[model samples]
Target chain A: MWTSRRRTRAALVVAALSLTALTAACGGADTAKTAAGAAGGKGGGAVLKIKDPGNSGPLAVAKKEGILEKRLAEVGATVQWGGSYASFTATVDAVRSGSINVLEGAISPVLGYLVSGKDIKIFAFTDPVTDPAAPQTDGLVVKPDSPITSVKDLVGKQVAVNKGGRGEYLLLLALQEAGIPADQVKRVYLNPDQGASAFATGKVDAWWAIVRAYPEAVAKGARVVVHGRDLKDQDLNMQAARTELLTEHPEVVRVYLKVLQELTAEAQKNPEKFQNVFLDQGPTAVSGPRLTDEIARTRYAKVPRFATAADGAFVTDVAGIFQKYGVLPTAVNPNDVIFDLKPAA
Target chain B: MTLEKVPLGVPASVKDPVEASVTSVKGPPKGLTKDLANDSANDSANDSANDSAQGFAKEDAPEREVRGGAGATALEPPRYLGGRRRGPVASTAVRVLVPLLLLAAWWYGTASGAISSEILAGPGAVVGALGELVATGQLGDYLLASAQRAGLGVLVGGGLGLLLGVVAGLSALGEELVDPTMQMKRAVPFLALVPLFISWFGVEETFKVVLIAVAAASPMYAYTYLGVRGVDRKIVEAARGFGLTGTRLAFGVIIPTALPNILMALRICLSVSLTGLIAAEQIGATEGIGYLVTLAQQYYRTDYMVLCIVIYAVLGLLIDLAIRGVERVAMPWRGQVAAR
Candidate 1:
């Protein structure tokens, strides 16, 4: 016979199970409903579900100031701030699943996803950094005491690079410029953390450090062999939105970029605060003076523009480079991936 | 008192009354001393007897001169398992010394320029950064979020695991139905399931939680299943003989006996749930300690990175302490011995 206590326990368990089942069903429906179009809020207005990059960048500034929300409201569209993603590439998978509809990131890594039949489109992009004096987003580095000084010297040496990423691409470009065979240089593929370790411990002769790594390596007395500035026009910071969202609500895309540009310009006016957005909330690897110097020397900050079709040419060359390096499994048509959000004159 | 000078196990009948004063002695037979009491032959696994002997050993020296005290032919026959317990002060000093030494080494390395600030921030910098996190209230928010995820994941996962384990352990039909499938699921790495889960559930709170749940569940199920199966069959028979049936027999008889192992499973589940936390929060987490790590990594903040590591290490220590507390409360019948 069932006791009252046991019955109560059973009832709680059943209740929990039912709640879980209902939640899972609701979530499944949410993915489908939001995947086909911009998410409609309870008030029947478009909700642009996007990951607002926090702690740094124009996106971070925009998020902090609610620029997107305020601007998009003019078009009956509201901005929904989802948290940022760790992996730029993983956000592509998120976009495909309709977990998010807009992704802002460095575009090189995400090419493979686009090549492999993901329906995402590059609607806007920051024009390439042309000035050689600009702060290089990433660079190849060596120990201060190491014998290697140039890309030519790196031949036959083990250099750690993030495979199929900007690091490897930068190294490839450097090797090409140095007139050395890419196969001659031993590429030790590793993630940033592992690469940092390998470089510090002399496990690898060189490390291709990216984003935060470049500035940090310079602080740690790592001598740079080459950075993105020394290479070609591959350093295009781009924004992409899903085709469904682009079609259903073009105004959301326009307002988002417009507000982002305005806010980015506003942020750059106080470059010190803008760069130090993290403040004491965390520790930065670079020292105070080093960051200030880099900020001073930084000649350009890429403000994104609605990409025209001409922007697709550089992407085509990058795809060729990716193909040559065997980053992508097969070739993809650049035309299919580039969708113009800017109206032609 | 010199125990080496005393004789042991000598019979009272063999000695004259005047010659052997301790022969007729009751508790600590007169000549018994600490060293002689705790011989290798008397070394006991159970510590209670030793505690009792030690209690009697603490007696003050007698003011009355020993006409027969030293003349006792035999020592107390009670064997002792003796080890000197370190004082709390000494124990705490030893604990404090380790991290201090490491901190000193780190300070020296950084101060002397052997360690670069880029590779690792100085302990002072990390403390400042930690203070910064606290001041901004980021730590509290991140910590609460992480705790909620781990706690809820453990509850849901651990509950399901316990139910399955009980069913499998009690009934052959249940084992045949559930065990093979669970075992198969166990072989698949939980990290590998992240992408699949994102596609299935989408990268929402559900995916993060369910991923943690899945990770927390497996160890729990395995341990619970093993614990239940290992419960004493004789006790189950006895409970059944006493007219207990179904849930009563299992819960009353089996589960109590199996509680130790289940507690161990909880410990493991709690620990590994952190692993799933890292993987889950990487996708689209806005809040949590993992988010701190992600931002730190992205923005190149080594201080915050090190701070996050310290947070994880501290969390691990706290979890272990919590489980130990649970063990003490739940298993009071078990003897308390200093873990080696």
Candidate 2:
């Protein structure tokens, strides 16, 4: 009985070992072949790998209109839209990993990524909040009946932010500009949903939120205490690629940027068409009024000719704020990180 | 050897007259046949005694056989069947092998360029990041903060759970009052209570700690209640006969018997407490292992993220091992019985 059992166990072990060996060999070969194919294909032509941000943004609109696909097709290349990311960080991670080739996110996170030694470069500026005349996309809100009427009133108060991101950066800048010391106010990190809820219930003295949440806050008897635009000029959003991608395929990058610039220009010239495309193709469910309001507020810029002093200064200032708030480990020069890719004049 | 046939209903001493005549013809003594018959009876009585002895041996043979089998199996047991007689070095080697293989695979994959460093960092990078975090004192501070929250949560939650569990297990009325409410609460995932907890406790240290406590409580209550309820009634009666009563009866008879379950519950509660701490910290924390992971994730620093995860894993394993050590010391008899 013992001999038979031992024999059977030995046979099972041998079978398992053989199977594992076979599987590993086949899997390794397949992975190598796939990697080679991907590299060859990328070298031959452009394959624009973009992440779906799961928002009704320009990328979503371009996807809906097939603008990117059409433009890339003209160059005999293809565009591959990857799965939607859960957050800006997730998108950046995907891009950094080369899973996605391009990511569109707010400038704050881009700077944050740069400071942290992620090899990413800005290729285009989209949705600039550069126009000070424009209504602010983000603001600091407080309950209507609250005694806090200004940003300085936030001192010794518990202010909630989406934290360690754009909202926190803006809040810190606003607080500094208001001549309030950073240590005086307590900063609480909450997601947008929680921040709004906290603001409504008076759990937090103030909330830093985007314009999309403004209507809901207002309905809950919250009023804007300070606007983010009031502190400094800000870029609402920008598109970036891995620095390696830029070095390897500058032409492809330029072509892609050119298409984006044209798309921005087209959207600006035909707002109604742009709104309709977004309404038709965007992932979000939007009322006509809200869609119109968002479209009216959005201001897209053509690809910048070069990294301006202002752009460098904006990043430098935000990085300083990040360092001050202990978000960044050390101060880094924004000029060193921002790559200016220009379309043909 | 054949004996002369005796007549039915006759005593062994009273042999047949015909058999006696035959024996005389064979030139044997007249009383010899009677004596032989008596000796036969004595031998029959001895045979019955031997049968009883055989029965006793048969009853005990399987237990001895089982012990022998257990000893043999213990020499090279399967990894999953944790029990006695495993060599310490072999057990440790077996335990460490799988994780080492996993680390090797990760390293190989990264070095071979199959696994991108961006999405998942190499083990070396993660180690370096851990070293950096340690040197900067960030890891120590974060770990300390997280540990404190989890520890406080376990103390408060585990204490309450033990009290409630004892009450419910000991008294029928207590069970009716508390068991139903606890069951209902257990049905809801603890993380779902974040919003409500925030509203009630505010997004402060109190909120995070309470979240961890609430999460840690349910398993403690369940296992402790089960442990107490499962105490042998015979043992309780025996203790009562020995003059144990009331609190003394519970502590002496019930608690010691139920201690294994309570310790098991504590292990489970500690894990849940850590999970709760991470989730709660993610919501509104500026410092902690969870917050560190979040910061790393935000900056796409996979090494830092992985380091925090490793720290959490190591912390959990250490806590579990500590509880297991306590269990071994507390329940020495369990180990002996299992070994046997």
Best by DockQ: 1
Across A296-338, the per-residue lDDT of candidate 2 in tens digits comes to 6554333333344356666667677888879788886866667
How well is each residue in B217-325 modelled by candidate 1, as lDDT tens digits?
7888887777766654545656666887655566666677677678888989988888888888888888887777876776666778888888888888888889889
Q: What TM-scores do the predictions have?
A: 0.80, 0.48
Off by over 4 Å in 2: A1-43, A53-55, A74-77, A126-133, A219-221, A234-236, A275-283, A299-306, A343-345, B1-340
lDDT (Cα, tens digit) per residue for candidate 2, span B1-28: 0234321222245356765434333322
Q: Can you tell me which runs of candidate 1 are displaced by over 4 Å?
A: A1-40, A278-280, A284-287, A297-299, B1-120, B336-340
Chain B alone vs. reference chain B, TM-score for every model: 0.73, 0.75
Error of 1 at A213 (Å): 1.8
Q: List the residue pairs that clash in candidate 1.
A: none
lDDT of 2 at B158: 76
Docking class of 1: acceptable
